[model samples]
Target: MWSNLPFDLLANIFSFLSPDSLACAKSSCRHWHQCARCLATPESPRRHPPWFVALPNRSRGLFCCAYNPIDDSSSSSWYMLPLDFLPIPTRPVSATAGLILLRSTSTTPFQLAICNPFTRQFRHLPTLNVTRINPAVGVIELDPGHQFGELNFRAYVAGGMSEAPGGGALDEPKVEMYDSRCDTWKVIGSMPVEFAVRLTVWTPSESVYSNGILYWMTSARAYSVMGFEIATNSWRELSVPVADRLEFAALVQRNGKLTLLGGKCGGDACIWELGEGDVWRMIEKVPFELGMRFLGGKGCWDGTKCVGNNGIVCLYKDLGSGMLVWREVADEGRWEWFWIDGCCSIRGQQPQNFQIKGLLLHPNLAHSSLLNA
Candidate 1:
């Protein structure tokens, strides 16, 4: 019956399916698989489940873990990703779709690589000319209407200090962007000294890219969320809510909007969204139940962190409190919490004993073989 349908009709049918359901449909038949690809447009608004990249306690490799709060607790949902996919001690600096931007090590003169954990396809990126003091990587989909696994993407490396004679605070910071089309990197623009100084002093966590802008928070800048526009190569900074004594904060893309999750030690936290003209609008309050629970019976809240994607957000305290996640329901006004215990436990573990890096990602079928095209 699927074979009889016109191509346009089949594309429309597959468009409404979730990412996992679409993957299942593609496996039904060759015709259905082709239809799935045709419908996987960049503009397609279909959402995928959020998966946490759990750092293993035993090995240097990472684990892709997902927990369904609605599912029975007895079943196992975490999958240990193969270590052979990338070099040892590879740090995933950024993630989009299924592709994660990795560096060989957390150290200087970073060797860049891109790999899709789902497909286990790995590809190396060009080496940077300068080692960033506290560098961050940002990725943008260049092809206006491309699909999930397509290689039409560009990577921008910004806010890193350079290695050169007379390297000082006055040294201007430049943006290096890699274009997949040319397969080369170029210096785009130099940011103002104030921004460069912050980058030098404080290395931000992995940045969140939405639309054409890359956003990250800086403690040195009073916890301001900095935005870098890829097209114009410009910078904009937005102040976060409750900046005083913010122990932890994260910027993530939810429902295609740039969202901020800020948490304080005194049981204060809230999620905010970028409103018109770069305004930070509070969307949802971090429920007191979750905050109080994170406090772990203590009267005051400790440090906390926010990690998530695809409308699901996880909050975990620094002192080994279990993870509390909020998953948004479609067309529903309420949000509920999901308990993800394995990944959140690493907060209390020794840094060398357990490495915890997470990205809320949707599995993508795109492969490195497409890069040959």
Candidate 2:
């Protein structure tokens, strides 16, 4: 039966299967495995790799951790990636375009790291001349369409330092750009608003890159979003409709538009899509009962719109069950809840190693199989 199907057609069919399914298909028969491998290659027209989320396990005093959700039911496993290799006090701030950005929490000079789990290749970014005293770092791919070889991939680090007690500037915040191509760093510009030391004072939220500019949200005890042009190195503040102060929010790309997921203080979640002229319009809001209570005010916006892989948006939830669960946004504004059992522990303790720290879906690995086949 397999012999009758054209090779190209079979390869295309395998592309839609999940990573686990792709592995099973390979074991089904030599022909199927070969086709499956070919379809998984980065060069393949229909390639989708497994997605990963980083969750810190402060229990062991280790600032680094993550979890990878496997589709396999029988043997669900989560792996651990430690930051012991890097300097101390490093925490993951963002993941974009196949790279994870980890920043140091130490007051001593620190550096940022752009790591690729699949390749196990990491580039330690040079320290910015600008000091980041409690700053937020935002990362994004400069050109998603351009291959790593064709265009330079960059991550934009932004945020300001806490202010002094006497109503004076304690630390000036600045934005810096890291160029993967040159293996160098450059200061772009400083943040427009002066930041106060108060924890209640919202510093810059996560920044999202779109159309050569990066956007971030500034509460300022008032509500507003700002845009920074990487090329021109200029800052522009924009107004966003005032909403309840969210403890955790993220900037994500959906269908090529920049979207915001705001988690309010009361465990409510709302989705805002960037409309014409970069206006933010609220699209969907999670009802209070939809396991939103677990969000604990933190969520990651993955550019997925499907049930299985892409368009998966996760909000951290602390279910009364005493376990850390994730509320997954499903198709048509539906919500599904899944528990990461034995996955989380409080500071200074390590949870069971069932969770995966970092996961890389290499479409390129699929291509290697095609060559051998």
Candidate 3:
């Protein structure tokens, strides 16, 4: 059978395998290993359950934990990634299409780098045009129509605290983008000065890209969402559901749709999908018993944070209590939950004072043009 099929066709079939399975197949023999190398590029993107990455709060070392969604057994379900080979101290700000955008807190002007933790590939990027504190940042893959050989992407930084000439007033915020192809940064678009301040103060810098729009959960509670349409270079805001009553919430794009996962303190955690007319349609909810177990007598859900993309959404305690994940089964037309204990894999390596949070991304081990420089 192996001799009957073409080599390129075998590589294309290998691209359909899960990363873990593909790894096993690669190690089975030498010929398949070559096929696995061809799986590196985003040109033939593979499908794998988006895993939740638990990053230690402080960038003490270059080690972080990865949560495997497919593993349901009791064995170690996390991978402690040793990124010691990469130079400089930095933390991941955004991850898309297997590349992580890391920001260096040690430097002024906020140095950024693109690295693939899977392959130990690292490259430092040019400085952002604007120096901002808690800026809303995003890394989006610019569509190359699958025609170009090189991977093209854009990094965005919008709405953050910037220096002003006088101490008396607020400075207008600017939106800047970095092009991987050109290896340069340029101002793109911006929001209102007041709006940018609010986003900087309340919202996390992580942005979710869906279709042509980018969304960030704005405000302390699940009050509203700020959206930026890249095609139009415009900004828009939409109110979330049950803004006043919900104790916790997060805006995420899952299964290629903008969805919100949130819940009240004593109620079940719920999922809502945004449908036509900008309305939220109720989808699923965690059972009462499961919700209580997730809370674990915490007494409040305010510390919950949500991060997910594509076909998965993960809810975890900000204090590193544990993680509750819901993954969509496309063929089944249903969703399932997996609860991973937070204290399992990276316990001894972290101190009691440290906290951890997970960001969902499909890690690509392929070569990126961002590394060309």
TM-score of each: 0.75, 0.64, 0.81
Task: Flag regions of model 1 displaced more than 4 Å.
Answer: 1-47, 56-74, 129-133, 142-148, 166-172, 299-303, 317-321, 331-334, 343-353, 370-373
**Across residues 1-373, which tens digit of lDDT does each residue of candidate 1 receive?**
2343455446756876889999999999898888888874557555334456553322245454433332224334444455565556676676654577677664556567777876777778777666555566777756534566666677777766666676553333887888776777888887877777665566554677787788877887468877798778889888877776666777877777888887666656778888788778987876777666666656454445567665678775432236777888767856776555543322243222243555655556455564333
Model 1 scores a C-alpha lDDT of: 0.64
* lDDT (Cα, tens digit) per residue for candidate 2, span 1-373: 2354455446755876789888898899988878786763334332232444443422133323333343312223334455444444455555555455666555444466555543344455666776555555556555553332222367666665544568655555566777765766787776655532321146433456666677666666555666777778777766655444665455655555676766555445677887887688997776555433343323422211111113444443321112222333434455444544434443445544432233222212122111111
User: Considering every candidate listed, which one attains the maximal lDDT?
Assistant: 3
lDDT of each model, Cα atoms only? 0.64, 0.50, 0.70
Better TM-score candidate (1, 2): 1
Q: List the residue pairs that clash in candidate 1.
A: 132-161, 133-161
Mind giving the per-residue lDDT tens digits that candidate 3 earns over 60-89? 454766765555454355567776866776
* Predicted structure 1: clash tally: 2
**Candidate 3 residue pairs in clash (backbone atoms < 3 Å):** 98-364, 255-310
What is the model-wide C-alpha lDDT for candidate 3?
A: 0.70
